[model samples]
Target: MARNFAHGNYSHTQKKARNTGRTARDQTRRTLSQNFMVDRHAVDLMVKAAAPEGLVLEPGSGEGALTLALAEAGARVVGYEIDPRLAGQLAARTRNDPRIDVIRGDFTAARAPREPFAVVGNIPYSVTSKIVDWCLRAPDLTSATLLTQREYARKRAGDYGRWSLVTVESWPWFSWRLGDTIGRESFRPVPSVDSAILLLRRRPEPLIRGRRSYQELVELGFGGVGGSVRASLRTRYQGVDAALAAAGVPRDAVVGYVHPDQWITLWERLCG
Candidate 1:
């Protein structure tokens, strides 16, 4: 007999039927990108990476695996699930657990808490960017540990030794890193690709001042005007050659090859 943690025990035939039902249900949830984490090891790894404490916000809390794990790890969790059935089930399941509050809604649309909090979840693949944007915009969000596509995580974390425009733009305020990778088999309805944990922790003190101007500089560098970052920036800043030298950036360096720290140095030299 196989035990369905979310539901209950099932015989072999019943398990087959349940799987079929899930496949059908998953068809309708394509827009939601509902891939439920079914592996306990994967759940444990996410919880460990997050090391969640105090208040935590969980997005796309399908089947309550991560939500329950987060609560067990001694954090007060507010889990948002867009699927009404899953949300209702989770709500009912955790009704007696004071630490867990299941909300049937969109996590991206939820308002940031006045007090400092952390966001942790196995988020929907389709809306990972949106949820990340929300976390970055929240003034009181101390950190976020999310399960996202491996490629997306690597890009944001600069795992491939190349920086992204968004990562550089936000680097002054948040530090991004890649955590453990979860195989596709970890999910109930296995996705085509593996997933990895993307960790973003807000800097206690921002690396730079004048965010608006710094972002503008970053934007101009990535605008692809004169090809290389050095040439592109020269169009706007007269001393760009000297600035690149000060930042240790090659005159012919591409924008994506420039590290965030180098970008900061460039900003200081050119705009400070």
Candidate 2:
């Protein structure tokens, strides 16, 4: 049974089971994705990496591990959790503290903040991409530290030279870093895949000033115009071959080899 912690009286009690014994392994609510992190070491790492101050936003707060950790690290925290049971636990744990707030619902649907805040989440795997978009577009965002699938973290950091559309588009503003792995055993339910932290720090000044044309350029190059950067851009815009030459990119070089520096040069010549 779920306990009530809504009256502002915080107390410690035995943790409740997620559901009745029957069908415990099966998925529950369609809207809620719950994975309570159980590893203290990994939790410590997240807190240290965040080194949070000011406001911190957490999605899928679960049982308050990240929320409490971040708050103790000096950040005023607001966490979103769709599970009533877990939400109640989180509320009870942090109610006496002035540094924390818990909201029960879908974070993706919430009105994002306009005041500068740092984000830290042991996020739901289902909404990882959505959270990435939310933080990147947040007008007041300072930095984001997210726990995501290892593969997702790698792509965001351009580990294999394969970047997502969001990664490419947000590159000028945020620098993405892949951090230490959190094993499957780190969670209570033991997810099939391992998770890792992704650190994104907003650049002081974008390597290239933010521009709408950059989005279009990302689509043209990565959207299968051709395998090579030279062929991709040259086919869509005039003088791209000459631009590539000026940027010091080889005509036959793969898009993977074309660095961010190259993209900036090409953008200036073609779109500026």
Cα lDDT, all candidates: 0.88, 0.79
Tens-place lDDT per residue, model 1, 117-192, is: 9999999899999999999999999999999999999999999999999899999999999999999999977899
Question: Which ranges of candidate 1 are over 4 A from the true structure?
Answer: 1-24
lDDT score of model 2?
0.79
Residue-wise C-alpha lDDT for candidate 2, range 1-272, written one tens digit per residue: 22222333122223334556624324442234556789899999899888899989888888887788888888999888766667777887777888898886667766778788988999988889888888887878899999999999988888877666677677788888999899989987777889999999999888776478886886788766678887787777999888888889888887766667677788888987
- Listed per model in order, the count of residue pairs whose N, CA or C atoms clash below 3 Å is 0, 0
For model 1, which pairs clash?
Answer: none
- Tell me the TM-score of each prediction against the true structure: 0.91, 0.86
